[model samples]
Target: MQVTNQPIDAIHEEVFADTTSGIGPELNLINPQPESCRQISAESPVLSNIELAKLKNIPDFEAATIPMLYKVADGGAGLKQALDAIFAAADKYIAEGKCILILSDRGITKDMAAVPALLAGAGMHHHLIKNGTRLRASIIIESAEPREVHHMALLLGYGVSGINPYLAFESLEHMCADGMLDISFEKAAENYISACTHGIAKILSKMGISTVQSYRGAQIFEAIGISSAVIEEYFTGTPSRLEGIGLDEIAKEVAMRHEPAFAEQNIDPFSYESGSHYQWRNGGEQHMLNPETIVKLQQACKTGDYKLFKAFSKQLRGSAFANQNLRSMLTFTP
Candidate 1:
């Protein structure tokens, strides 16, 4: 029930955490609807170099500038290498009087896979915390991965001071140019940020949290499918009861994205995969409430047939697909 637009707190090293419930239909970040997320949006001042590239026009974003930036040597070096490089850069940056460290996947190439931004951010955070030097400087992310509220919340929770959501901004620009969005690009980007902040507030309010300072690094939820080893290492101190996946799963997921990004095949770059998270897509991710189930329900309603209804219900609830939730993992015992 508590709420505040401006969050005030002295966030030491304990401001980053991985408390999200990982049992979504896919392995995307899911802020529980019940708990209210704090901050709404990060209000802290962050210095960054991204202004030289993208994000040069947003009002009130260019508060400061970064003197030094760190990055992985190559994107095709695999996930482990990328992480190692990031951690190494962390130590060097901290030692060199650098106040803001930028972890970016922008240098990744097509030969190898991409490291999930969540992993990079969370890994660097814990690494710094373990070394007892996390509070030395802030972390900023310059990537194309984060676009939605949940994505931004995860970044904030994992200890990033600010995010240069260049991809999201570019998408808005494209939408404006293509007439998909009625407003100007700047207005669309501002609205997107507003939407993310409000969405995060809704999640924090569900958990009864009042501010981003309290919510940052709080690790508010439990992991449903991720493994304990992964949580201990990256999400450290967060709960993973099911012990589901490890680095292998994460690597595979990253490859799924990396493979298509640089493929030399003849396909439209704009024709991206229509992931069926909300509405269903052809040859895409399967959803419980898909068109097939909807038609069956309609047919059963029209005929008043119990058997038809049962079939529809069974298919809707007990079907198998890549998108798995906690609901399908449960069973009744005698």
Candidate 2:
């Protein structure tokens, strides 16, 4: 959020100029391409070399207008190699000691914790970053999705309190524009949204409130004897920038289960205690159907249970495709 109107071209040159002098090795300097020379030289003063490198590698980095989304390939030396390449690419550009933002996939998040290595790779000493305000940087290894990206873009624009969402988005966008990642904007946005929703659901379940029923005065209504109204208040009061963006519909469905009306509406046709009805009081609402029904649905989805998965997918109105939450849980293997 803290940025100076320092000309982008000036910033770029200052960063590369000092480092480009008397370059001793290929790994030490980036050969500034002519295309890069014509673009903005200066960047926001706060970005780090590594962060800028990641941004520069985003797909279509040269002309990225929309938000960028980078994909970290699953389970290979691919991620490490990609990181190395990006660093190599930006070594000179970022050497100017500019601050840069970096948003990575969850898989690479652990790497951020190893600050020492990052500093070393950027040819800087650890102690140099001791000043908090001067070296301010953010590394978030959060879920990525199209909706999440869009929401993040909006949040970055909002700049509430002291939280600046744009740094993360800019890092991500730059990386995407630069072609360092193999992910698409839409897919990234979807993944981001799914991460947020599922993450919140997971957090709520741990708190014994499995459903998020509202975002205003009585959001996140719980099962059992808890009041749905209180949960709504909690959610609305939380002040998360993500509150109203892409989660309204999800909240309504999750909250509906806790409503007294849901209890009355659910009816069982079979003679069993669970019958055909699902109740939210006993974590039933956490799921879209009765627990007993879900058990069968899980089985059906697994063993080529196309008939069941299809029907269930229909009932859930294609959430399987949009969110893939159920599909992931059911397809998961040991």
Candidate 3:
């Protein structure tokens, strides 16, 4: 059962191909008109929609009010203070009948060290809900791939109402700036947003859901490897299978990832883990689809050898690629 030409690379390229061609037509779905859905903008200094459309408006959504965007510090001791302020702000907004809060994690680090903050935000949202405050929570993260989408779904199960993957937009900007992409920044951003929306929609569809509103805070997922203590606190009501790392462990993990950024700050203020984005480069960030692994997976797929594919996939499951690519979709029993 020999397979044909290796299509893994081609499939990867196609999955992330330029989406500019279909963006304009999807604007109505991405940013619904005020009449279609109540929309609000928080007057704040942040990434311009020219870089990424952070706001999402769906017509006839369940929510009666639009969300107020809130940006907070990425991580550190200051994170607690920032979350306190965010909670206060959310209280005010909820009192004012703004039932949705958009927690923006753009301009954050590549490792997603802000997961703790996201959990804290979810906790606050749940607190409000418990106190009879009618409100919802959404997140704007730097997610890119299908695995990232699954992570977002986890957040949704933990109380996230919506998600926007701004990293996809930033990747587009970088590609266009590097001349690897021919589209303008705005067009690329639009296309990226559309792509993320499509990805999220597909995830929901798999669960027999037809709309994002229905999926909000549904807790439709099970945490396989997370601590019960952490789950009890931030992810209340959510079930965890294995006893995993706790909040302290999570904080330590985030600190470890942030250490390099702080240590090398003097060398470059805007320094980041190189190759953490769309392109895979050495000594930058962790990625699943590196040249070596992609080559191996491509070879296995081309040969139609299930055993070969399994070997490559076993390696992938143990690597960072497990959380960044659509590895679940590549299952082969043989």
Top TM-score hit: 1
Question: Which should have the higher lDDT, number 1 or number 3?
Answer: 1
Worst 10-residue lDDT window for candidate 1 reads 19-28
Identify the candidate with maximal lDDT: 1
lDDT of 3 at 112: 36
Which regions of candidate 1 are displaced past 4 Å? 1-77, 299-303, 316-334
> Roughly what TM-score does model 3 have, to 2 decimal places?
0.54
lDDT by residue for model 3 (1-334), tens: 1122322232233343211111001114455665433333322111234322424353322122222222223443444445556567666765654444555544454343353535654666566667656333333322332125555556554555444455555667788999988889888766655545556555655555544545556777677667886677566777775687765565666677555754633666356544456677888666777887888889888888888788777878774555664454367886
TM-score, one value per model: 0.73, 0.20, 0.54
Ranking under lDDT, best-scoring first?
1, 3, 2
- lDDT digits (tens) for residues 103-167 of candidate 2: 33223232121111121122111112222221222122222221232232222221100112333
Q: Candidate 2: where are CA atoms >4 Å away? A: 1-75, 87-92, 101-291, 294-334
lDDT of 1 by residue, 176-288 (tens): 99999899887886677656665665555555564554566566666778888778878898766687877767676666666777768888866987676678888887677
Could you tell me which 10 consecutive residues in candidate 3 have the lowest summed lDDT? Answer: 18-27
